[model samples]
Target: MADVQTGTRRAAGPRDTVWREPAGIGQTRRARPEVVRVASKAIRKSAAIVLLLALWEVLPRLEVFDPVFVPPLSENLAAWYDLLLSGQLLEHFQASLTRSLAGFGLAIVLAIPLGLLIGWYTPVADLLMPLLELFRNTSAVALLPVFILVLGLGETSKITFVLYACSWPILLNTVSGVKTVEPLLIKSARSMGLGPIRLFQKVILPAAVPTIFTGVRLAGAYSILVLLFAEMVGAKAGLGYLIQDSQSSFRITDMYAGIITISVLGLLFNLLLLTVERRFSTWRT
Candidate 1:
């Protein structure tokens, strides 16, 4: 018994000497300083953007660039304030918002169903791909005249321009999503005797959702770009018109404000989409 105990102790000795720290009770404790360091890094990164604005503000005043083309941040801010106070800025913004939203809504409605159809059906996708590719390649700006001819130079033309530009991305992404459904899942589904509708709902649609959303996001981006271009071509209101009108009138400061507005709108839309993506992608997390 003494020999056995010694042997057992000897066998355990190396393991005991082996350098393993004690296992954590549950989650490993994150160091406070490390956490602070991470947060500080994030702050620094965020502040870099502010630093850029500061440079933009300072550099022009120093005449590092032309004041006419590169106006000071202060001038731009003052311009924005003036416009905001006058309420003309809001009028332009509301008009742009109304047009963009209307066009985007229509594009979403069309793209979603068409995308699903093309994606879920290989033969349909094959048939439609060429035409879609053709149109996707076509410069949306080039169609401005055609839209004007058909719908007049009114809001109708502007809306049509946005819709035409936005539709392609959604349609293409949808096709990608649908066509990408896992074969194994489909096989398993078929074996289990799930009907076409049930298989699509339970498996295909869920799998394709991320792709569908990707398209929607792309469509949102495209709509903004197209709307800006269309408004530049023909419109008396909206942010695009604001930029053109301001620039043409040599109100460089107001032009900067309009550009800033467009940037803010795009950022908000992108943020909204990202939030939606995060909300829906629980399984991924």
Candidate 2:
């Protein structure tokens, strides 16, 4: 009777607890909230963009500004389509891209090595700092006439102008990056018998790359600005030339189209640099 009672008690206790969940089930539930939080943050950032686009589409219809001066987004889009169809946009885009890339490329090639040297050697830094200050303080616009006179109103002049404008920030940032590398890292590498070249290649370069990229991004922006200015000053075929011509002819729609194109190009350039930076600097992230 007692055995029978004990068996009954055991059977009724909890019925095996309905297969209780394994450990960490609560953690899995917690992770879901984290994911939702991240998604919400992304949505919040994008909200402003959506609002701006809506305002862009609605402002002209409300007639807050003259439809002629502030054409509806649809009219601007139509102007873009017309230019695309005529192939004028493509030609000018190619010209502007070529000049910008050439100048920006030259700046990168020249600035980085020179900057590394200046940052690596005290004497080099002392010698170049004064000269760097002198030229960097001078405006690129002020030198436009000099470049035009010396290099002539040609592709070379435009490329040179972009090079001059982009070099300063890139060089300066690279120097700062190199100088700011943690001394501990360098000492550790030296203790491991790493030579100067290997030390720089393995430790200094990697450490400084984030700062260097900051300058590169700045140079990219300067590249576009300088290219547009250079193209406007003298160019038979380019986006700047198209904008100038359209404005002079009172083709406001087409001018806006050109401005939009340049803005889009600048955005793409920055996005490209950002993507590159993220790919190379994953550890920092």
Candidate 3:
């Protein structure tokens, strides 16, 4: 009878046992699909750029385009590498970056507060709107000569040109952001006994952040574009100067390298702004 009971207990033990996967294994299995999804999305988004680069590489080699005027992408990349090795690339990049950042930063600092003031106060808007409209209608390119004449052909002129170009977008967008805050949000805040300053801090500013960021991104692009033009016209060291100089000297590969560098810089700057925008506006999500 004891042997029979022992045998029965042994048989039941297998059925009573429970099994679980190791925690790491289960987590890895769940994570793989997410990783794959992210990779696939990135690849899809980059497909067009890859196609364009392939065409750039092949077309010149195939003689479809004049190689003298438009060198193969590989040649341009080699030239870029040479420039990097010689430290010329870094020098030019620093010059351009300094001017761009100075102007861009100043514009942001000045425009946002002034924009807030104009947007919030009707009397101020009434006084400034006409002048803003007039200046806003004037092309930055047309005013380039004026800046050069007044500010002179130094760093001041270049940076001021960038500032002038970048400020309009940010200022306009800020004003619009503030004015377009939903009336319902304001009323809700008021009902909660929130004062004007608290209302602005808690409700208005948060609501306006998306619009404000849109302006900031636009200003960022303008900073690069306007600074490039300024550098091309007057600066001794910058990507624009490199491109202009290379083109004049018939160094097609170097010109293309400079052009590519500018494009990459613009892309990277925009990406940075986007990251910041996302951080600030996560409340929307």
Off by over 4 Å in 2: 1-43
lDDT by residue for model 3 (66-107), tens? 888988899999999999999999999999999999999999
lDDT of 2: 0.88
TM-score of each: 0.86, 0.84, 0.86
Off by over 4 Å in 3: 1-32
Q: How far is 52's C-alpha from truth in model 3 (Å)? A: 1.6
Error of 2 at 237 (Å): 1.8
Query: Per-residue lDDT for 56 in model 2?
Result: 73
- For every candidate structure, what is the RMSD over all alpha carbons to the true structure, in angstroms? 10.0, 12.6, 12.6
Superposed on all Cα atoms, model 1 deviates from the true structure by an RMSD in Å of 10.0
lDDT tens readout by residue for model 1, 147-216: 9999999998899888888888888887888888889989999999999999999998888888788788
Q: Can you rank all candidates by lDDT, best first? A: 3, 2, 1
Identify the runs in model 1 with alpha carbons over 4 angstroms from their true place.
Answer: 1-28, 31-35
Best by lDDT: 3
lDDT of 3 at 277: 85
